[model samples]
Target: MATPNTAATPTFMVFATLRDDTDFAEFAALREDEQKQLEVLRSQGRIGAHYVSPARRATFVEVVAADEAEVAETLATLPFARFFDAEVYPTTPPDPAEIAHRARA
Candidate 1:
């Protein structure tokens, strides 16, 4: 059965294996694309919030997405995210953006 795209709510796991280490340029190319997607995600009314768990700069991640597939194909599958293996698991009241923002500071 095809999972319904909740559009408004669901967890999207974004993960990827390095297709090639020498592909450094690959990630650089999509830097702007990533920010654009974040804008799309917010404007589309998909995610209420989201966050990541970085394991040693690069590894497994658990992302909260409005749709599982959306996170993988759109966010995590991006060049910047292609380095880690990710899983999208349901999080009640998805992680707060404030926490991530504060962490950056």
Candidate 2:
């Protein structure tokens, strides 16, 4: 089964990995700033979901936006933008059964 996509609401998936030259001190300093920014986005109903990778060093975020430019603008607000390499993918919901089958495989 194919999942439906709404033209009015576009979804984006962000995968962020720590850069080799990331400075821990600067990263720590920006944590509070990023958290505050995320809170504002959340309040605005922009963020769909967010999670840290199992390894604890990476982050994955799902956002709702009008277009790619909006997604890029939102991501640019993150304080750690310079410290991470990020990939942004346009996404849609997947079938639950297919996801379960993949898990079983």
Top candidate when judged by TM-score against the true structure: 2
Please provide, for model 2 over 37-99, each residue's C-alpha lDDT reduced to its tens digit, 9 standing for 90 to 100. Answer: 898776665665899874867999877677778877778877877887889999875457534
Per-model TM-score versus the true fold: 0.46, 0.76
- On the 0 to 100 scale, the lDDT of residue 95 in model 1 is 48
Clashes of each: 2, 0
Q: Give the per-residue lDDT digits (tens) of candidate 1, residues 13-87.
A: 333444445366766687698667666555544433444444433433334344566555555434466544555
Name the runs in model 1 displaced over 4 angstroms.
Answer: 1-8, 11-22, 48-55, 58-83, 93-105
